[model samples]
Structure formats: C-alpha cells, structure tokens
Target: LLIMFFTTGSFADKIGPTDGNIVGRETDTVTLKFSYETSNEYILLYWYKQDTKSTPQFLLYKSARSANSERKPTDTRLESTTTRDSTELTIRGLKLSDSALYHCALR
Candidate 1:
C-alpha cells in the first residue's frame, strides 16, 4: 500500500506604503504586490478599517481573480487593477476608510 497527501498555502507580501507613512488624506493611490505558487484558483483581496474597539469593516474591494475585476460598492471612489500571475493590485482614490491590513488568499 501507499499513502499520499496534499497541502495548500499562499505566499503573501505587502506592497505600497511600504515606508509605513501615516496613509490618509492626500494619499491618492495604494499599491500592493504579491506572489503565489498555485494555479487555476481565485484570489480574494480585501481591505478593512481598523477601529479601537471593533472589527474592521470592508473598505474598497473584494473577490478579485484577475487584473480586470470590477470594483464594488459602486461609489466611484474606489478602483482596483491587477496583473496576471504576478499578483499586483492597484487601488485608486484612497481614503481614511481604506486604511487597514490588506490580505490575499487563494480560494
């Protein structure tokens, strides 16, 4: 008899504001870059708002699989664009609410 196993994980890296500047008013764009080792999977990029006593809320985008995915919440203040495979995310019209830890995962 033989045994085999499989596992899944992601390689995440932060992009943009890498200098840790207090990103808020005046910041026009936020960009992030990441790389992964998987194929035929969808990637979900999320943004949240950090609060003192509560969980973060969704800020700008979600469920983006390709560089051409559409922005959500339709306020015309948030926009996202990406590059295939390389995993680059470009966000426009950044606001205070757009401040939070950005995360990416394969789904």
Candidate 2:
C-alpha cells in the first residue's frame, strides 16, 4: 500500500510530515509524523484522511499542551500522539483501503 501525507500551517509555524509518501503491506503498522513549532500556550492539532476522489475525513484532534484533551478517533486501530514539537498518527493492521492522502493541520 502507498500512503501520502501532507501538512498545513502558517509561515512562522513550521509543520510537515516526516515523509511525503510511504509503502507498506497488510497487517503492517505505520506511523506518519508531522513536525510543528508554535509559541501559543494552547495547541490544537487536527488530522484528516482523504481517499482518491473523496473529501478529507476528520480522523481526530489533539491538544499537545494538554494531556487530557483530545477527540477519540472513529476507528480503534487509529491512534495519535502529540508533543510540544510534533505529532504522529499511527495506523495498525493496515489494509489496502488505508492507502490515501493524510493531512495534518496545526492551530
């Protein structure tokens, strides 16, 4: 499977995926990492997944500054981890349908 990843942020607030594309097999585990920098005390991040010819779907959102603040993912196999300078989306037991473009946004 092939997965593409992207990120959105302001000029000063640098953010992007560690890899633009990734290749994996079924049942494999993949972690897409996005590096970000911000000065605000409150940090919120959103993750989206877009399949071919489909609108991006909201996967989840997390506040890096708050450990207990986050939106649970619709899928149990999906997990997110956040830090002061980066965030990651981890997909477990990957399938062919998991192949898509992922976008991460920082606010």
Output the number of the TM-score-best candidate: 2
- Model 1, TM vs. native: 0.46
lDDT of 2 by residue, 1-104 (tens): 99998788877688988776989899999999998888776888899999999999999999887545899898999999998898999999999999999999
Q: What is the lDDT of candidate 1?
A: 0.44
TM-score, candidate number 2: 0.93
The global C-alpha lDDT for each of the candidates, from Candidate 1 onward, is 0.44, 0.90
